[model samples]
Target: MMQLKWEKEGYIVSDDKTLLQMGKIEAWISGAYWAAGRSREIIEKSIQHSLCFGMYDKDGRQIGFARVITDQAVFSWIMDVIIDQEFRGKGLGKKLVECIISHPDIVHTKMGLATKDAHGLYRQFDFEMDECMRRPLL
Candidate 1:
């Protein structure tokens, strides 16, 4: 099984399958999509093309999450990173992204993500937007 070790907290990140895990990840992240009124179908469809990880506290309760979509070769886009409100400000976001960024499975691909206010959070992992613009570029 694929696993990620967080030595500081001594927890393992794995492929989450339980309903509790699914619910926890969904609950913490759904609000951003909801506030934008994104449909449930979009979220579910996104999950299929992505890799997801759930972070656990010392007691092993799910507390954080992140995901990525990639072609496993040239590029990837990280998405939906969040720690519960209670879990913020403790560096868990850093740890969670650390786990995802350094995962053995995805190390070879170029990574990217879209975020509004968390630019500071992702910068620590070397994520940034390119000057390359994709549009009718006026």
Candidate 2:
């Protein structure tokens, strides 16, 4: 399991699935525009298949989350990044993403993500807009 700590702030970013709080994760994604109406079953399945990251404060309460679908070699697509409402604007989201991209398993892969309005955030990590296309399954 990969773990990174912000010693000064007592915040941790880890890839330990056992530390993930499913209810909180489901609620966060269910409320997001891109994943609104997503079922808990689907969320669980996605987390099972993806490399997951969970962020927690000193008290071990989950406050943010993200996941990556990757081959761990060539490509990594980051998804479901959210910072708990109360923790927003504190730079925790940025730190979560930093830990994800810097993880040894996927750091060298080309990273990608689709965001409705977080272009600025992703740009800070050197993710650039590209001519890419996607197809919505019927």
Candidate 3:
């Protein structure tokens, strides 16, 4: 996997290994969902099956992430994206999605993601609801 590095407001993503940055990642997801009156099961599942990316402070503190789930052949689901409570209202979320959509594993496949409120942000990448994609890679 390629190292995660992208620049955002008041932060610069680094070569942080997001899977190992579990505390921050968990905080990001758990807090975001709870504020929306949802559950952390989404965060737990994200840790298990998603390619997670962390946005870091200049000092390397993780502040944000988004996850992608894919078979590396047919479909990639961009899911459960969140930035820290201290770090919203900027375009950081968009940057995170762009990074995942452009990741080496996910870019080549058709992408699918479910969002309840961020349709405008995702539409920038042409993401829309579709059938659960089904097929085999050749």
The local distance difference test score of each candidate is 0.70, 0.91, 0.69
Q: Looking at model 1, which ten-residue stretch has the lowest summed lDDT? A: 11-20
lDDT of 2 by residue, 25-119 (tens): 99999999999999999999999999999999899999999999999889999999999999999999889988998998899999999998999
All predictions: root-mean-square deviation over Cα?
3.6, 1.4, 5.5
- Candidate 1's C-alpha runs over 4 A off are 10-12, 17-20, 33-35, 39-41, 132-138
Selected candidate, larger TM-score, 1 vs 2: 2
lDDT of 3 at 129: 67
For candidate 2, the 10 contiguous residues with the lowest summed lDDT are 1-10
Per lDDT, the best of the predicted structures is: 2
Model 2 spans with C-alpha error above 4 angstroms: 1-8
lDDT digits (tens) for residues 38-90 of candidate 1: 45566666666677777776788887777788776777777888888897898
TM-score of each: 0.78, 0.95, 0.74
